[model samples]
Structure formats: C-alpha cells, structure tokens
Target: VDKDRDPVLGEFFTTESIETCADSIVRESIQNSVDARSGSRPVDVRFSVGCVTKSETGDLFLGLWEHVSVSDEEAGRLCAENGFRYVTVEDFGTTGLRGDPEDVMGDDGDEENEFYFFVRAEGKSPKTGQRGSWGIGKYTYLDVSMINTIFVLTARGGNGPVGGSGPLAIGMAVLKNHKLEGRAYMPDGYLCEVRPLTDGDDDEDAVLPFGPDSDMPEKISAAFNLQRADEPGLSVVVPYVPDELTYEELVRSVARNYGILIGWGDLEVTVVDETGDVATMDSDSILAVLGSLEDNSEREELIDELNLALWGVGLTPGDRTELGRHPLGKHPSWHTDGLMTEEQAKIIRDELAGGRSLAVRVPVPVTEKPDDVTRWSYLDVFFGSSEKKANKPHFYRQGLRISEIPSDTVSGLHALVIIDDEELAGFFGAAEGVSHVNVSSETKSFKGKYAYGANWLKFIKDAPAQILRLARSSEEDEDAGLAEEYFHIPEVEPEPEKEDEPETDPDDTGDIEDPVIPPIKRRVRPYTIAPLVGGGFSVTVNSEVPEGTVLTIDVAYDMPNGNPLKNWAPQDFRLDYMTVEVEGCNLTERSGNRITVASTGESLFKVSVRGFGSNRDLFVDVSLSEDS
Candidate 1:
C-alpha cells in the first residue's frame, strides 16, 4: 500500500474534548499576538467563522469550523520593517486543528507531509525578534480537522525565484484525500485552490486536477473559482466543510477562536450563503459584546443585593455616583433618595483617606440584630476618598478597629459602641469612672462614682457632707439616732457566790499589787516690774508647770520694791489688757486668768486660786511687787 494511501490514525476525541482543547489554544494565540504588537505598531485582530455540514451518519464533524487568514507577506514585511517580528494565533487545539482527531494524525512519516491553514499576522516579541516560530502554529488547523485538503496562494511585487523571490509572494494547495485512479476529494476539497484574478494563457494550469479522474463528489468542486488579487500578499482557501456546520456558525466560531483576524486590516473574511449572497461579520462586534454588560433592572437588583450582603459584613454602602465608578457598579433609579448626604459623604471620604487601619463603630439597638439593622450601622454608610490613590481616610482607615459591645457582661444587651481613633491610647483611663446598669434588678444596678485626676478632691469633700445628711435623714425618719442607739452600753450583772467560801488572812500568801501614785501639781507665779520714780520695767511670769494647760493669773505692783510706796500707780497692765486663745480648740478668754494655748512660754501669766477644800477664804495671788 502506498504510504500516502494509508488511513490517518488517532483516538478521535468527543466534541466536548474538542471545545475544552480549543479554548486554551485560542487564548494562547491571542496572547502571542498581543505580545508581538505590544510596542510601535498597533495590531488589529479579527476572528471569523464559516459553516460546516455533515453528509453521513459516521461523519462526526458538526457545526461551523473556524478559519483564520492573514496578509502573509504584508504582515511579514510589517514585522521586518518595524521592530515587531512575531505573529501568533491562539485558539488552535493542542492537536493543532479545530476538527476531529483523524485529521491531525495522517500517515506518521514524512511520506506525504500534512498541511494546515492559519492566519499569518505580524507582531513584536517582548523577549526576542522573530516572526512565525517554525510554522508550528501554521499546521494547527490540519492536525484537528478531518478535512485533508489545504490551499495557499501569494502575490509578489517582483517575481524572481520559485517561492516569489522579490517582494516575496507564495501560494500552494494540498489534496490529501485524493484517489489515484478515480475521482478524488482533495484534503482541503476543491475550494482549497487559489484562482487567478486576471484571465491568462495558463488558465488550464491554474485549474489543477485533484485526481486522475473527475468522477468525485461535485460538492468539492462547488468551492472553485475563489479569486485572488495580484496584491503583494498571500491568500489561502479551504473549500471542504462538513455538512453539519452552517456558514453563520462558522463565522462566529472563527471570530471566537482567532480574534486577531477581525482587526487585521488586510485580512477579510466573506462567507457565501446558500443563496450565493455573501455576509460579512466584523470581529469588533463580538469583542464589544463580550466586554459589555446587560443593562436591566435584574442587574441593578443583583448589585443592590450584593451591597446589602456586604454591608452586613461591615462594608459601607456608597452613593449611586460612587457606586458607578466600579466595573460592576450599579444604581437603581427608584432608590436614589437613599443616597448619602454631602456631610456624610465627606466624612466617609475622610475616613477612607485616613488608611485601612482605622475603623468606626456606630451603635445599633440590641433588639435589632447586626444583620438586620441598616440605618444605625456604619456598614450602611459609604466611606473612602473620592480619589483612587488617597482613597481611605486616616481616622476611619487606621488605628484600633471599632466594635459594638453589649452593655452588661451577663444580661443586658445594651450596646457600647467604641470608636478607637488611636491604637496605643486607650479609650478610657483608670481614673475615669465607667459604669453599667443591669436593668433586671432596678435598685441593685451597677453604679460607679469616681473622679479623674484632681477632681477626686471634690468627690472626697462632698462625700462626708452627703453621708452626714443621709445619716441624719435616716435617724429622723426612724425617730431615733441610729448610731447612738446601736452603740448604747448595758449595765453588768453581779455573779452569784458559793456558800462554802473560806476566809483568808490579809497578808498570809496573797499577791501584792503596785501602789498607785497621784499626779503632782506645780505652781507658777506671775510678777509685774515697775520703774522707780520716773522709769518703767516689763513683767515676766515664771512657771514650773508643764506645757499645754490653763492658768489663772493676778498681779499687783508698786513703784518701789517690797512695798506699795504710793497710793496708786498707773494701771497700764490691767486684768483686761490681753486676749488669750488656744490652738486646735475654741476656748479663749480676755478677763479671767484661765487660758489655753498650744505652746508654753514666758508670755503666759500666773493665775490665782480661790476655791479650796475647807476654808472659803483660802486665796493665793501670783502677783509681783514692783521692787522685787
């Protein structure tokens, strides 16, 4: 058997496998194209597909097959002239074709080289300067498609060699499924050939035969007469398509697969329908569709629901204008009234600008679960700066995170919302009295009364006054002095004695007790000094008594010593001359000799004692004569 005649061999994959494999291929091809076109020239890529139809039950090919064509020489020249030297095609399957497995594994050896069709576009490689890597991607179409025929054609500016040497243009066709003796269906079918634009003497040569005979299915011939322009580039045609595929489906599939073809300015795709009317589809339309979002109330509702859900998790809801900034941002016309006020918006912007470290806690009612509460929660408020970079505010963005806490540690569910503006500085100091109330027991509620810093002095000063008033009020209400009544002493009862008591002598063998000594009293005298004739002297008191006591003093002085020399002397030091006072007590006197003072000194005067035990006339005057 001829090597070319051998049947293609491979495990044909199902349609699902083909789609999975195709997705990755398409992505990689587009990435390569994008990378090549990164700098210098912009690359416009377009993808288009044509229809396919199946003829028999065993024929597995279905729907439309993708076709990618590029301006080969033009793209190559663009790459060489510009810095871009790479052209890539994505969406080709791992097997290199968009069709069944049998199409890819035709005759393992090089006996009959299998060929595939692909678009050739130019781009710059980010890493290296290169265009078309060894034609590896070029054969991707043949590897997957069961179609055995391939067609390629090129036009040259200056013809010099076999491969179009000058301004190089080249075109070729392959018919792998052709029969040698009878009519044969070309591997790419009859549509694989490239027809000349201008009629020439070699028209017969241009119309190449697929096999030795012409009795093959006319469906392959139906693809003939595809004209090629004499422009400076290549044109390729693949004619045979499975009956299961439609032209529209094929165009869509190709557009989805090789997205670059649509943007290729020189490359254009036209699919003729059954009526012979050609329809053109732009790849940009598909791209626009993919990038666009559906505008509807359902979408708006979905966005609102998401916002509500995230709000429960502590994210604040933003206004419609702010929400419009996100890619998925949505706003409902009906809910516009619920937007934030200008002040609230400013606060949110400031908080977000602060940084992610800050957070604020807004108090919510205990009856309203955090998940259910909306208005009172911070989650309902929008935060963050209007600018993207300096977005979050410092206070709300940084410091200690805020949280809402229950009022009582055990029972009451009151919320203590604490917004920690700073992490290091605690919200409450030690001296700051903090209290909570358990409403369960009305009177036994928790109450703390303390002062911070110097304020404690005021609390201390008022405490005694308040306590005294409370004590007095309680006593008045009860008709009794509580403290005095509670502290009253009772009389002691005498013990009963035994009848058989022995008599004891006073000094026989008894314990002796120490004798008690009485306290001794010391006497102090006061003296007045006077001058003789015309001069005067000062008086001093000499006291032998100890400090801190009251004494009664008297003094009488004459001009000469030891005698009352004159009838009378000027009474300068009278009984009522000096005033007396005691420290730490309210006792004071002006006339009497009795006085109290904390210190003892010579300034104190002597006192006179009048009252005695038996005699009413017993008197002692602590007076000093002027002469002595």
Candidate 2:
C-alpha cells in the first residue's frame, strides 16, 4: 500500500481529514469540476440523493457487509424494507477523467493524468495546490461511503462524443482489512471490466480502473440513475449513505463555502432531494437559496454574512485597489510602492469609515525554496466593518473555506480572503492539517517548498486583519527607553593599575578598599532604539540611511554575567517569531537572534517589533551590517 494511502481503519480517513464530511464532499466536487473546466463555460454540479432497492443494484458489494457495519443490522432491515439511499454527484462542462485508461503509474508523459490520479492512485491527485499536499480533496468521495464503495463514470475528451464513444465507469472501495476466500487483502479494491488476461502472468493484472470500454460501466451508470447522458464529465455514486446526511445540508455547504464563487458567476450547483425537490444555486439564486435557511438552527453567522455585508469582486483589474506588491527574496517588505500611496490609504480608510466594503488585489510573492528566483502570485481580500461583534478572520484557498490557523480576533470586523492563485493556493492547501481546517506551516508541504514558507503563510492569513488595522489606527507604539543601557558601547581609558589592597582578616577591624572597575567602551548609535511593551522593540531613525548602509539588529536575553550575546542560542527563540513591523526599509532576514534589513532611502522611518514574551528582559542591540 502507498504510504499516504487513505487508511481503511479511518473509514477512508474521514475522521482525520474533515470536520464535516458534507462540506468536504461539496468543496472537493466543485474544486475538481472547476479545475477540469471544458473551456470558458461555467461549471455546473448536481447533487442528487434518492433511494434504490438493494436487489436492483445486484451483487455490487456482496461480501463487504461485516466490514461496513457498525451495528448496521438496523440499517440492513431499513434498506430491505424501504430501500437504501444513494447520492450521485454529477459535473457538467468538464473534460471527464482524461488520460490513458491503463496508465497505473504516472510515467505517461502527460504531467497530469486525471483518470489515473483519481481512479488508480492514492494520494496522487492531479490537482494539488500550487505547492501543497498530494491529494487532500479526493478522499472525501470514498469517505462519504459507509459501505466503503463508490461508482465512477467519465468520458475523456479525445474519445468521440461523450456518452457515445468515450464513456468509462468503475467502482472503488477502501475498507477495513478483511479476508477474501480465506486470503487477506487491503481495503483498496476496484470493480472493473473483467476480461481474459493475454499476458500469461495472472499476477500482472492489477486493480486498474479500465480493462475494456464495455457495457458494464454503462449498465451500472443507468442502474444508478446517473444524469450523465454522455455529457463529458465524471459522475460518482455513493451508495448506502447514512440517512442523517440530508440534501439540505449539502445546499448549505455549497452556499456557505462557494458563495463567492457563485457570486462571481463561475459556478452553478443544484441540490435534489429524494422527493425530486430541487434547490438551484447560481449567481442570481445564491442568496435566494440561502434565504430558505434563515430559520435553520444550524445557520451560522458566516452564512449570514452573505446577506449582511455588501460584497464586491474584482473581475476587472480596475475594480480592485492594488496594495503594495511584495518583492520576494529581495526584501521582507512590500514593493518600494509601500503598502499604498498616502492618497490610496486615505481612500481605503474613508471607505471603511463610511461602512463601505473594499476588495484589494494583493500580489503575493512566491518562491519554490529559500532565496530562489521569485515568481509573483495574486490573492484577493474582501473586507468591511460593522457595529456588530468582533470576529476572527476567514480564509479560503481554491474555493474552499479553511477554518483553522488564525486564532486572533478583532471587534466589528468581517473579512474574506480568497487565494485563487494556483501556486500559493496549492502550497497553503497542502498546509491544511489532517482535519482539513487550519493552515499549518510545519507540514511537509511547507517545510522546504518555499523561502520563509512559515512567514509567508502567517502574512497571507494576517494580511486582511493588518490592512484593516492600518486604515483605522494611526499611532506609533510608546517605546521603553533601553538604547542608553544596551546599544551604546561605553569606553574609558584603561584603569590605572590599582595598588594591591590587603584583604581584611577575621580579627582585623580595618575597612577594605573598593576594587577598581573597568569602564565599558562607548559606541555610537545612528538612531534611538527602545523596547516595546512586548519583547519587541522600536527604532527611530532621525535621518535617512545612506544607500549602501545595511542595518542589522541583534536581540538576546540579558544575562546576569553582563555580556548577553555571549550565551545566546536559537533554542531560546527566533527573530521571525517575534512581531516585526518595519516601514521605509525591507527586512532582508530574520534568523537566530538577528534581523537584517536593507535601507530603502527613506528620510525618516520607524520600525517596531513586538509579541515577545514580557517575562524576560531582552537586550536589543542595533548596528550597521555594512559601511555607509
């Protein structure tokens, strides 16, 4: 089994990967459809749930009952009498799982093999984020199955008309370890077209998605009442669904997660109940569909935001306000443009102050690894303030709402961040933990994928919050006067050789002479540096740093031995973890106990660093990294 295989013990990892399997199903389905769009046409997804008699489907899962049941006798009786319920998700205007049918391994020249990745492989999705985990979204389909089985039908583009010549179908199961004919087998099982093996070695026949383009897949497709009439897309049937998961929840999931997508007119979805009742959601009906859920006990504030806040998306470049662009690898600061021109900043402040909404086009800098050639990527932020209670920030990458990561909150604030950029989305998407909620920088997807992956991740999540703060507040932090005691190097002429003084004896009553103390060297500081409330500090530059002047700041816990820098260690802390706010200069590096910044020719600049633990006193020393 593959190392990253969705474990059978986990019921296809539903417990590990998602908080709500309902949302995961919706998020995954729409994301796949969007990625596989067939040209400029908007994607349409249909979620239909209904009942099917067990006898009608025949021996599809004849032997997996024991493995599927968790006190399922009640389920068996219900199904036998009233028929088992099934969920069929169908997508339109998408090139169905396209690739060589039998390419089990990814050696098929094509960088992306949707067919192989979805049907034949585990943890090898064709649609990982720009730089993310292998396959986080694909497991939901199988996980939704209580019986650990699902049927798939697709029509690749190269094959004639969709339903006519390119249709292919198969069934997959990821179940608990079990025995077949007294022989043990892993949960990864497949139902494919069976034919005579021409290769004499019977063992060479693997559990592949396609053996032949036969009538079996089509027959199963018809039996499941799938609506894919050769329309060129993938349709999946998750049978034996738990009755507790209703079609309405799916509707709420779609609306809650993809409201922005629907508002943008890029997606359309329909949810159908067992009674054939339909709830259609598109650009016009998104709000209308959600209106029905107003009385719902599960209705959340996030869902309510769809109606509460005025939203605006920038389909055109001019619709969005451009913030400062980050020049990755060049500096920790944004492009020389600064966060925004004074006029632009004022406009943003006026909008927020007037209770108006704003959307920003933020250019996120991306790098594959530390200090590599930088590539630019873009993510958008939509924010507004209200008189209502404060709330935490909400983040979405590739159309899915990521719940974890930002724990900080601000009052009367509402913001939605969308990372539609494929590269950054993928990187961050992969960072979403097994719960598939919070974005993490410690994951393998982040560790070596980019330079300062951790820092960039925090910045993106905090961008909207920071922007809101910038617009509403204007005050420099009060500084603790510590420069006089730390940065300056005091010096004095070598103390005159002190005449030896006799030590006082136990019986003597004479007073002892004080020892001669050496004076510290007096060093010069170009600017005043003071400590902030937290472990951070601030630097006030009275004059512009020369073009070639490189400034480096070092911080360490003040040791009683006198020389604080002598025993500094990384195990104690990192500069990046401390809150750093720098303007008029780009922080080039934050490592170990030092922060290096490049001068940006600003005549007067203020730099602040905070968020350090207040328990310990830190000695912050600032100096020039290079000659001016």
Question: TM-score, each model?
Answer: 0.23, 0.69
Off by over 4 Å in 2: 1-19, 63-82, 128-133, 159-165, 196-203, 208-213, 296-311, 315-319, 327-337, 434-436, 473-628
**Mind giving the per-residue lDDT tens digits that candidate 2 earns over 240-287?**
787666887788788877776776788899999999899998888887
TM-score of candidate 2 to 2 decimals: 0.69
List candidate 1 segments past 4 Å from native: 1-134, 143-147, 157-227, 248-251, 254-628
lDDT of 2 at 252: 79
Q: Write the per-residue lDDT of candidate 1 for residues 463-518, one digit (tens) a residue.
A: 21221122222222221132222211111234444355456687787676565444
- The number of the candidate with the highest lDDT is 2
lDDT of each: 0.26, 0.66
Highest TM-score model number: 2
Per-residue lDDT, model 1, residue 498, is 35
At residue 231, give the lDDT of candidate 2.
75
